[model samples]
Target: MTQTASMSQNGARGLVRGGALDVLRFVAALFIVLYHVAERAPVSLFALHPALSRGYLGTDFFLMLSGYVLARTYGERVLSGGVGTGEFLKRRMLRIWPAHLVMLVVFVAFVLGTAAIGLAPQNPQWFQWSQLLPQVFLVQAWFVPGISGWNMPTWTLSALIVCYAGFPAAWRLTAKVRSPWTTLAVGVAIFLAVDYAALAATGIPGHQLPLRFGLVRGIPLFVLGMLVARMPTTIPSRLADGLAIAAGLGVFALQALGRFDHASLALLSLLIYAAGASGAKGSAWASLAGRLSFSLFLTNQLVAVVWFGAQRAAAARFGFDATMLWLTWALALPACVAGAWLFERLVDTPLQAWIKRWSRREAAVPAPASEPIAA
Candidate 1:
């Protein structure tokens, strides 16, 4: 008999349990929470010192993974012509907006409630209508003044909008790949061109990258992911394994020595991607992270506001020395997990479900045979 099929899409990329991707996402989210907690805690907690902080790395992982997952989830649809501009925007809105709106409302309420109880420090100046409207409209991302949003936690939503705004063109361009490498080359060229063009113009590519791309910075990373999906076996295992070891060791050594900056950090990021792309199996932990990653990214900040507040209050009540910081991080783990669960069920889950329901179709359209997703 032919070899048994061990791997499968298993249909629909909806939250499948026992996945390594989800687990990784959860861990990334957990790190963000811990990072925030440590930052806010007393320095007496030497173990929770800033030196131990690699929390922001979580965002890097997220940006890289976003491209990868979107390729897996939506690449087929784009190729098949199932996802059109209208349907594309609709589905994306379904995926992100409902939960987003709910979160915004919750954030506002929490702030107001905390203030009501006199638990939160008053910054009445931060509560201006001028800044509030842009955030509610999700346009605050374009408005620096609105960056101080009461619900300023919606940066991803804004970044995503920037990404997908160009999705139709990206799909059309890659839709004509003669081979995997051809498509990969095209995507890589775009990223490098954009990367260097900004540099050539500003004299420093990486430094100018943020100002040049701003919200669209995630697009190149996202395209990196799409290219990975298009060229599933671009990097051989042995070479990738070596690269992974080098990258991991480099990151650890740098972090250990506190010498890693943006340049080294970028290289370290590339290494992480190479390693992750090499024969990545869906481990249980990764699955957990992938499942909760979206929630974690979006929910962590919301939950942290209250959790951190309570920690601050408690530390104030008792005499918490710097040593208490690490303990605060320890306490944050359970609180975040529990909060993520509740936030998911009460807010993220239902909102996500409702959005999905609104956009559900009886069949998924495939692209024309002349322009297959992997033609």
Candidate 2:
């Protein structure tokens, strides 16, 4: 039986529930939040701690994890036609779009409210009207010019949309390659080819592809993830644990040494595989954190905009000290976490539930009979 059938037989618990992957998801989300905060903080956190500069690797990890998770969950169904492509895309959109649209609206309101109060944003170019349409359609990352204004991180969403659209074909192609080693080889080759082409053309590595063309960066990492999912997990749990530890340490060591090379990517991939294979069923807290990871990621930018804007205004009014400024910047992290929890509970959950209900109703209703055309 396939994994999906097994899931159905076992109450739909999913393959990676309450696992190390969940903890990693939460950690990745937090690091991404920190990276953004470090970028915009007034005191320059990177100077004090250069490791914060490596937070962008969270995104790389996420792209790969997404591929792996989707492959494990849906690859068999997709390959066997148990889930049609259209239905799969619909499911993906439902998962991602609600939170994304909510964030987009919040950002729009933020920009308009700031304008109404005669307050100019620190970066006015990021709030341009020209970019709104692409953002609304979630196509901002598809070769669109100019910086991703509004919520900057939503560019990942745009890239992921393209990945989802192509996933059926990617799954089929990867499934055809029986040898996991050969699959890994193909994925690495694609990643290196894209990396080299990006370097040659734009002086940027594949992993650092600009927001306007994020699909270039997203696709290979996603494929790599799918390939990783195909690999056997026959090692002992203790061995998996050791490899995970080493890979995690390796990633940090490379970052500490200011090296962002293929070695780091290799370590990340190893870390993911080892963590998954360790069979560590995490606690409820870890599962909750995993559930909140998406919201944390989607809301961090908006939280930053509001949190820092208010901090700036307060500092200008009250003349904050260095200690006070740092305190407020530190506070933004938890504020982001709280905001994500609230958004997920209040907005995304309710909206998705309603969409699901409406979809069920639509499915229940019968279609009108077709009339015969005039001869």
| Least well predicted 10-residue stretch by lDDT in candidate 2 | 1-10
Tens-digit lDDT string for candidate 1 (1-375): 011113224232222234334554566667666665565554523374444565555555566566655655566667677677666666666677777777777777877787797765434455565766666656555535433546444654666666666675676677677586787677667766766766777664522233213454456656665565554434565676677677657766776677454544455445645544455444555544555656666666666667767777787799677668567757766776776677776777777666556545533556578884522
> What TM-score against the true fold does each predicted structure earn?
0.73, 0.92
- Cα lDDT tens digits for candidate 2, 101-197: 8888988898888889898888888889999999898999899988778888888889988888888888898778889899899899999999999
RMSD of 2: 3.8
Where does model 1 exceed 4 Å of error?
Answer: 1-18, 44-55, 122-129, 143-146, 175-216, 234-250, 257-286, 321-326, 358-375
* Candidate number of the best TM-score: 2
Shift in Å, residue 345, candidate 1 = 2.5
